[model samples]
Target: MDMREFAGSSFITVESLRAGPREEVVVSVAPGKYDKPVATFKSGDQLTLNKTNVRTLIKAYGEDSRDWVGCSIELSIGPTKYDGDQIESVVVKPISPPKPLAARTPVPKPPPPKNDMNDDAAAF
Candidate 1:
């Protein structure tokens, strides 16, 4: 049995897409996502780039597919018209700036050591 059969959906989706618009590194470009040339991501999800998506990538990364490898792109679901019907589709967008690290909570300082002298005086 092909182990990849259980690897989940080969195509990326809004629900399956990683949280937020994280940059996805291109693993390879091949024909498979939908019988057409698709970009495979490091996560093993393949995305068939529509014309708009292709243009977006081209504008951001240029035309060379070889150059596309190792490059980052953000995938998100956007409204698109298909056969006169508006449907949600995977779209590629330029990677956004990395979010700033969350603020860390400062560790509380330990309480001052008890003064032995004070205890001795109290006992007197």
Candidate 2:
């Protein structure tokens, strides 16, 4: 895509989780690859760009596990001054599977001893 357009500020499309809080996220401009600094964000964090910047959809998440819900994304670019500033905040709810319910079947109880085979309760 066009990294220049994404230079100012924009949201990232998290694809999968990587090492630490980092995750593989996609950028609107760089549709071919991902970006760098793979760090997570909050509802009001600033995403920055550095020398090791690349166009990749993968990023190292930090604390956006409750926001980026593995779905659509809406990049919000800040002013040109804070283009490469630290991500102020983000609102991404990580999409995760729901907790399991109860078990299907219960364990069966042992059968009682036969009257004739009973050692203690057997009648004469």
Candidate 3:
């Protein structure tokens, strides 16, 4: 269950992921189309392709998060097709995760020592 932050604009390809037969690909989204994928499966409902057919799939997902926006793209094997070495490698750039929110409360500073009480210690 690997999670990534998708800003709603990233190119992806099956070759880059090295997908194999009977493998499943899972995509999870938030408010925006660009939310990072939430899960991936090897086969079954979560699976999109199988050993028999490979198709070229290119799609995007997008969503609006408050003031921020996001989306993503997915490319897979098409019918009667296999991405071999002949096909140029599609460069899929990695997405960076969002930063943590800022703390609401302020940190307190330590109190300073009293000068009068330290006067005797300094005299010694």
TM-score of each predicted structure versus truth: 0.60, 0.17, 0.17
Instruction: lDDT winner between 2 and 3, please give it.
Output: 2
For residue 73, model 1's alpha carbon misses the true position, in angstroms, by 1.0
Candidate 2 residues 1-124, lDDT tens each?
7555445543342222122133223322212224434333333223433322322111322222222223233333222223667543322222333222231223346799767765677577
Better of 1 and 3 by lDDT: 1
Off by over 4 Å in 3: 1-12, 17-19, 25-27, 31-76, 79-124
Tens-digit lDDT track for model 1 on 1-124? 8676578647777676546555688878766545557888877778777878877766666565555677778787788878999987777877733222332223357899987775455554
**Ranking of candidates on TM-score, top first:** 1, 3, 2
Model 3: lDDT of residue 65: 23
Q: What's model 1's lDDT at 33?
A: 47
Q: What local distance difference test score does each model get? A: 0.69, 0.32, 0.30
Cα lDDT over the full model 2: 0.32
As a TM-score, model 3 comes out at 0.17
User: Per model, how many backbone clashes are there?
Assistant: 0, 46, 26
